[model samples]
Target: MDLWLTLAVMAGAVFLFVTEKLRVDVVALLVAVSLLVLGVVTLPEALSGFSNQATVMVAAMFVLSGALQRNGALIAVGDLLARIRWKWLFLLVMMSLVAGVAAFVNNTATVAVFLPLVLAATTANRWAPSKFLIPLSYISQAAGVCTLIGTSTNLLVDSMAREADAVGFTLFEFAPLGIVFVGICMVYLMTVGRLLLPDRGVPGSATADHIGRYVAELLVAEGAAVIGRQRSEVLPDGSNDVTVLEILRNGAAVRGDDVRVEAGDRLLLRGLWQDIDATRKSMKLKFDHVARDLDGDLNAERLHVEAMVAPGSHLIGHTLAGMRFGHTYRARVHGLHRRQLGIRQPLDQVPLHVGDVLLLDAPVKAIADLRIDRGLIVMGSRAQRKVDTTKATLSAIVMAAAIAAAALGWMSIVASALLGCVALVVLRLLDPDEAYEAIDWRVILLLAGIIPLGIALQKTGGAVLAADQLINLVGHYGPTATLAAIYLMTSTLTEFMSNNASAVLLVPIAIATADSLGVDPKPFLIAVAFAASTSFATPISYQTNTMVYTAGNYRFSDFVKIGMPLNIIFLITATLLIPRFFPF
Candidate 1:
């Protein structure tokens, strides 16, 4: 009865998490607490996961990755996208490189670094960022599945493999299958599917002149002229050029056009640059001129410092108001370069989040002083000369060399990565304190919380029982069906949850099922890893996908329109390719 109940509870938790009814962190904690309280896990066993070596390794990697990112050691190879002569070939080459790099780094972090650059490239090359962003995100995820240290999934699978056999996965164990699969994907994405991608409503943006900046507000005064108006109706005299971006009334994230312009509801608008003065005059709109140059007032007396929101900063959650930037740091909140969602949004109203590159144009004197200050790590701004290029190159080389060493079995990926981190610090690529902020606790907690549940499932004989049922259902049709089923299930789960968690859950099942069938487990394991990592569907599906989704100013439907077909294509290919390569 306890076993059945436990299975039921676990299934329910996964379902709830997939449906997003409860927050993931909260769900993870609930599962951990329930296990401890019910005695399925003793206090030590339950708590032990938090301090697990795998969890620490994953966390440490983030900080090390951050060190490289803050110092600009990592440049988006997507910047080289302009080199491609053909558009389709360009998309393919870009995605391939991004995915390949993602295999060694966090895909989300990889996409975050590239989002601005991709946006800039699209503007430079007369292409839509929406098309490249999602593709790049998906590629990075796919690439991450290529190496043991590429993603947390590889790490989780390695840990599970060690427990199963004395010979665990080496770093390059995945390279053979990964290279083949990724190669096929690259060719297909470049040749066939690139033409199918949507050209979203984005235009070229070389200079500031390319952007539309207008000041129009929802007039909330009593008996105001623009009350109870639709988006089109609120616009001035049917020009169709002006737009109402948002209505901030009473601190709510609402989507309403006829929101009844009550008192205190702030309005946001965008329009043509030349018409801006006339429109503001005609509508009698009052808007703060945010695009004004920082050369005057306040900046002349002080230093102007710029910092990209380094990974794992204390500044992630708090707003400028809550952070007391003016009160504590003696740094005035000046300009910002924030991606409110994916593309650039007005920084004035932006609720600050992690990885936001803030253009802190302050006084010139304080600029150099702010460079190594505790919180804000300076990334070279537009006018700022590329500082310490030699150190940056050295840091990048160190990271790459460490990866190469780990992959070749000179040291554990964890040890190699940590050594690389130490080298980065020693070389002064990233400050010791700044490195600490780069670790994402949420992802680490998710890993720590879910690992024990996988163990519990194993202890309860759940994996074998599940395998037996799967065999009964699909074994007669043969192992091909079984592998396909496993791939599909793993892929669907990865799309809905974290790829690492999905890989962890499916690895035991795949190995168990393979043992039952008397076939090679490597192919099945590879299928699980690959399928779970290639999430091209929704922004919410993966971290990297989310990074680009907002930065490109993309609609939710855009990913579906772009990735759904690509996913189908990959799914069909995996079904055929897995058996041919490894023989299920």
Candidate 2:
């Protein structure tokens, strides 16, 4: 009965994870509570994950990653990479740099830091972002498996191994095989993978070309030059940059090109930022909403930026006007891009959703503040600011010290990371509040809540039962075949769920299978770690992929075309190499 109950809980959790009806972290917490309620795990066991070494280390790594981004260390590197002239050379170097950083920082954060830089580079080189972005995300996943601290999945597998009395991996134990995989991926992406990528993005100016046009409501101010002219005469077809989408008279839509413009009349106009600014200046127009709500002039030297609404943001489901977004963020939403919606309504009235790309116009100083807001991800900006050398140097030194300590056995991975976090705060590189916000609480909570399910599987003997079934299917073929099966199962499951969750669920079964076959569990554990970390077949399979999905303007089929082959390559490489490395 206990075994059946545990299995039933696991099945339900898997269903929730794949469907994404709830947030992954929320689903994980529900799984923990369900296990406790079903009496599959005791209260202590259910809560053990919260204090697990892996969970704490993952959180600490976030702070370390955040400090690097906050202090301009990563941005400085981006500035140098932006100067590469040739497209192929740029693509190769960019992936290599991103992979190196991803080995130490969180993969999502590494991608986030470089995203704007890559977009800007592509725009400058007249290259499509779709050609480069998928490779960026794929390479990060490959490099993440090169070191134990490279990804949370590696740390989770290491922590679980220790709990099950298996030897934990060294910091660089996976480096040899992981580096081989990274080389293979880098080569494939530059050669055959390049052919499969879609050329979807329009290559032109970063601001005027493909960023999309802005739709804003502007009022014809008193004494405006065009107040007495007909709308057709002032904004005739192909006459100027601004297109009058609709003419509003006292809150009613007035149709026809013959309608005469009047003072105080609101005209919904669409155009590029430069053209819009030129038309507004020439016509003496004012933003209808900005004039009514904001005290300052909208004509200040402004920065145009493209930002996406991030997942788990408080701003989700709230209209820009309802939230007073202009007042709250000190920025004006000029236009928005939603992949699914046509966006026929007023921009301010539309409720924001995840992955909505917002084109913003704000004062130059506001760009920094906007970047810090967790609610939005700034994809690109027109401004090029100077980096603080002092902070960048300190952050680099601190991150290096942490990694060296762990690798040299001077401290455990968790302790070294904690010490590094303290040093960053003490050095004034990151504020206390900034440090707190840096940690992705969703990932931390997901790890904490879902880890107990692994314990429950062990206690209920469900892991052994499942392993028995797997062995019955493939054990007769030899241990190598069983290893291949474990790797394939893990990689398949990771494509549909959280990689860390997949690792937690499968590691126990992998261990049990190894024990049953009287082979070394190290090979199986290594397979699980590699398979779980390198999720590439779907955009939703990994966070970095999702970050680039909408930004690159890619379709669902783009990933399948490029990533499926890469996934198979990694699987084959791991199967042939894991046994040789650890000798099953």
Of candidate 1, the 10-residue stretch with the lowest lDDT total is 207-216
lDDT, candidate 1, equals 0.64
* Residue pair clashes in candidate 2: none
Q: Write the per-residue lDDT of candidate 2 for residues 1-584, one digit (tens) a residue.
A: 88899899999999999987677898899999999999989999889999998999999999999888877787767777778988789889998898899988889888877877888777777778888999999999999999999999999999998999556999999999999999999999999998898887554445234344556677888888777777676663443566777667776667765778888887777766567767777678876656345436657677667888775456777999799898888888766666544444566777876677787778877788787776787776433445788998999999999999999999898999999999998989999998988888888999999999999899899999989999999999999999999999999999989999999999999999989999889999999999999988888898888878878877778888899999899889988999888898
lDDT of 2 at 453: 93
RMSD per candidate (Å) reads: 6.2, 6.5
Candidate 1, which segments miss by more than 4 Å at Cα? 21-23, 76-89, 164-167, 204-219, 226-321, 324-387, 518-520, 577-584
- Candidate 1 C-alpha lDDT tens digits along 211-329: 22323333344455556665456556754475566665655534655555554455565555435445545655454333344335642575444455543456765676665555444
What is the lDDT of every predicted structure here?
0.64, 0.84
Q: TM-score per candidate, in order?
A: 0.76, 0.83
